[model samples]
Target: MNMLYLSVRQGSEKARIWQICDELLARNGVPPSGREVADIYVAEGGNQGTGFTQYSHWKKEYLARQEQAAPREAILLSPGTVTFRSMSVTADGTIMLPADIRRAMLLDEDGRVTVSVVDGELRVISPMVAVRQLQRRTRELVPAGTLVSDELIAERRQEAEAR
Candidate 1:
């Protein structure tokens, strides 16, 4: 919340101009309004300052950085489409999948599953399906009838069994 007063350099009064610009800049894609700008001004602790003067230095700096910004390093959150459902870990540390999802995945109560995190969402897959998927993907990547391919398939099978 570091702030600069435009009036300070001029030895005059408050700094409203930069404050207006900063609020406008901070609004990202939202259409502008006087209320939104005033809200931003108040939210940035503007009311505390003398004569309500000055804009946030961070806001100005943010715009500058955005102008020359590199690609953002950010995580992709899964689309939260799973509705009317919440799960808790059981005493045995296993979550019982919902009836809908279990039916969709064609899973039985006694069936074994491979659980994985993809795009921050929990995924449950059948081990056989997983193995076949791996084999298919491996075949696509590695040429057939290679010693390395055979070894990799064997290793993957072993790992899958161990899980």
Candidate 2:
């Protein structure tokens, strides 16, 4: 048997204390204090300090996770709605992209991207989009019915004859 399972046979003590706290809050609609959990833990032959410490640590981490998940949940609940969020740039000039924006940009695979600034706004273009834009521009510049390959061949023949 795993030594970790032998600790509680169900879950960690932190989970147990959190479940207890949640149940108490649901029943009375009021949050329980550390002292109340410590008292119950002591009565059950567990350490009072352990109960309070576990509850405090679990609550802090759980709240942090919930805060981080809120944005993702909103994106899932409402599709096609724009989500404007502020992100702090790291000291190393790294700006983390959110999951929704990454998915919209089709950046599922790691590849080179062309980053440019136009009108004071940063633009990140994937290779596929960049190539399409280049193709469109080339078509506009080169008029219809102009064979670039034939022109190159004729120029090469003229150069060869002169040589």
Candidate 3:
């Protein structure tokens, strides 16, 4: 999974960002402190200093770090969409993927999938597969929906039951 530090402007500390992060943290059942959440914003290029000059430095450092990190992309989705790609589901049910990859999936704020990226290529997956995978992986830390197709799901299910 990719780790991204998103920075937000000091003035952008509104309810939307907070709501999303809160929901995300709550879904994972790991409450993050304000400082920790602030850290992500700082990493994303947010100004952390009290004054203008210090804030400028923080922004510079954040940008530099982003440049050094792996490239990532985000996909924006309209409201009322559903389903996304599931890269890998862990034993503990934590769905892991690069933050950029998640963004590339273009899931809307409601966690609905509007797009998907597979092997660095963007394509749409069937809604059935998407939903089933999501249902199976809902307990995951960061569910990315389902990527496997119906045939694969059937085969995997059979294999699991056979064991």
The candidate maximizing lDDT is 2
Q: How do the residues 34-137 of candidate 2 rate in per-residue lDDT, one tens digit apiece?
A: 66766777787778889988766544554455557677644221123237778887999888877666645534234346798999978877544565568889
Give RMSD (Å) of candidate 1 vs. truth.
Answer: 22.6
Which residue runs of candidate 1 sit more than 4 Å off their true CA positions?
Answer: 1-85, 106-109, 115-123, 142-163
**lDDT for each candidate structure:** 0.50, 0.62, 0.46
**Model 3, 38-108: lDDT tens per residue?**
55556766654322333333433444554566453221221124356557658995554454544444332
Give, for candidate 2, the lowest lDDT window spanning 10 residues: 1-10
Which residue pairs clash within candidate 1? none
- Backbone collision tally, model 2: 0
For TM-score, the strongest prediction is: 2
Candidate 1: 10-residue stretch with minimal lDDT: 72-81
C-alpha positional error of residue 46 in candidate 2 after TM-score superposition, expressed in Å: 66
- What does candidate 1's lDDT look like per residue over 1-163, in tens digits? 3233342354332445354644454555422333444455677665545322333343334445554554432211111124556679889887767655554453423366778898998777854356556888988986666778579899999999999
Error of 2 at 85 (Å): 6.3
For all the candidates, what are their Cα RMSDs to the real structure?
A: 22.6, 22.2, 19.8
Candidate 2, pairs of clashing residues: none
